[model samples]
Target: MSDATSARCVKCWVHGRVQGVGFRYTTQHEAQKLGLTGYARNLDDGSVEVVACGEGEQVEKLLAWLKAGGPRSASVEKVLTEPSQGDPTWTSFKIRY
Candidate 1:
């Protein structure tokens, strides 16, 4: 288990064939399972934006999943990630509009 005191946040923009394929829902489910707190939302540009926050290890796991092409039906082309503080007010993983 990762040390919660060393938690970090990341914002990922998943591109290519990611919209309308249950990506956000799957992301939320995976993040929640990892005990992460954040939100996944669809972008107008046809990508998916995910903000995840949690212990470093868990966040890394989530990133790996994202890099692997997201959910079952997603045809991920590229993923862009950056360090983010995310929402300090978030208490759980959810699919945001």
Candidate 2:
């Protein structure tokens, strides 16, 4: 998708060894690199949940990277992505509580 049409948003659920590492931080970096605005957070179930809004290709790239295991120490097992609804008004990516 072109950057213009790619303004579509995405929300992802990442599973596996994604907690206690630098996943959130790394995700923030990646999101910033892609010019995405959203949040990443550790789920109570030991998974990482990421919501990003930006170009479709960039969002897909981020999802692919996360599926391949994030950063150096992450062991991602699965990644589920879906179209996001509503607006994305985040000024910066953050590690949500």
Winning model by lDDT: 1
Error of 1 at 11 (Å): 0.5
Q: Candidate 2 at residue 60, lDDT?
A: 78
lDDT of 2 by residue, 40-72 (tens): 999999998899887778877888788888888
Which runs in model 2 stand beyond 4 Å of their true positions? Answer: 1-5
In angstroms, give how far residue 30 of model 2 lies from its true place.
0.7
Among the numbered candidates, top TM-score falls to 1
Candidate 1: tens digits of C-alpha lDDT, residues 1-97:
4364588999999999998899999999999999999999999999999999998889999999999988989999999999998888889999989
RMSD of each: 2.2, 1.9
Local distance difference test scores for all models: 0.91, 0.84
TM-score of candidate 2 on Cα atoms, chains taken together? 0.88
The regions of model 1 sitting more than 4 angstroms off are 1-5
